[model samples]
Target: MYEIELLINGRPFRGAAEARTTLADFLRHTLRLTGTHLGCEHGVCGACTVLVDGVSARSCLMLAVQADGAIVETVEGLAEHDGTLHPLQQAFRDAHGLQCGFCTPGMLMTLVELLRETPHPSEDEVRDAISGNICRCTGYQSIVDATLAVAGAAGTEGSEP
Candidate 1:
């Protein structure tokens, strides 16, 4: 067992993280923050996407110890402190970005990162941002709309095509 210290959504987490535990397993199984799902288990799927110091990355591809001392944010951590939905999450609801909800968590988390870089992403950019993520249920049109709506809500237009 390895002791790993990480800040998750501003909460300090320090404990015995099994040496073999992936960050995804640590967040979901150990921490009980199950919003980060294990889809492909490979880095390609992006289903385990989470923010490590404000950037999106595949949690399953990393060891729990690798996240030590890192600031990690999961889908559960995406809400405002006052409990209001983040604008992107609101846009997703307004635009029906989710169908099965399996990919929603990762998509939402990835959107946070994507929007930070491109507040108003064009439809194509939105698609490209989440290209690593796979959604078997929704066809992605609504997700694109949702992301675009967030960009519009933010009063910033991303790269225009």
Candidate 2:
């Protein structure tokens, strides 16, 4: 087993995993951070998306050892410690962007990276940013609308969690 250390969601985490273990598996099984769901483990489904050093990454495609010493952000970190929702999350809820919710975490993390890079993205940009993330429900219009809503409201200033 290889020991890996990561700064996750602002907290430090350490765990041991086989060298072949995917980061998603390490996060879910070893770290007990089930928010990083696994679907289409081949990395096609974005359900396992997370932020590694502020960039969106497919956790299933990355090994735990590969992510060692990296800063990771999962869906569980999007909300405030006081139970307040992040603007994007709140917008998603208000706009009904989620249905089955399987893709919400990936969608959120992807948009988080987009907003951080482009604070006010156009509708096309929002759509492009989430193109890789597939949502079986909601038809994606709601998700685009929700991201636009957050961009409009906060200009995404200080939106980083």
Candidate 3:
């Protein structure tokens, strides 16, 4: 087993897991951070997306040991201290961007990275950014709309997260 220490959602975690254990496994099985879903274990699907050092990554693609010294932000970390939803979360709700909600966590994480990298993204840009993520529910347009709403520029003015 390999020992790893990481800062996850603002908390420090230290544990011993198999060196080959996926970050997804460590998060969900060990830490119970179920918000990081496992869509396609091969990383084709972005369902396991999370913020690794502020960039969106498929947690399933990396071994838990690889996350040593990394800082991760999962969907569960996005809420306000008072339990209020972040603007993006509320926007998704208002725009009806989810169906079964399985993909919502990944979508939110991806959007957070998108907004951080480009506070204001064009529709095409949004689509391009999320191309790796697949939503079988196919609520894509509304997801885009909701993302735009969070950026506070649904009309192409570009918004930031």
Better of 1 and 2 by TM-score: 2
lDDT for predicted candidate 3 compared with the true structure = 0.88
- My TM-score estimates for the predictions, one after another, are 0.92, 0.95, 0.93
Query: Candidate 3: misplaced stretches above 4 Å?
Result: 153-160
Query: Best candidate per TM-score, number?
Result: 2
Candidate 3 — which pairs collide? Answer: 119-159, 151-159, 151-160
Tell me how candidate 1 scores on lDDT: 0.85
Worst 10 residues of 1 by lDDT: 152-161
Residue ranges of candidate 2 with Cα displaced over 4 Å: 156-161
Residue-level lDDT of model 3, residues 1-161, one tens digit each, is: 98889998898988888988999999999888898889889988899999999898999999999999999999999998899998889998999889888888998999888888878788898899889888988559989998877776533544345
lDDT score of residue 96 within candidate 3? 89
The Cα error of candidate 2 at residue 132, in Å, is: 0.4
Q: Residues 1-161, candidate 2, lDDT per residue (tens digit)?
A: 99899999999999999999999999999999999888899988898999999899999999999999999999999999999999899999999999999999999999999988988899999999999898999999999999888898775365542
Regions more than 4 Å wrong, model 1: 156-161
Error of 1 at 62 (Å): 0.1
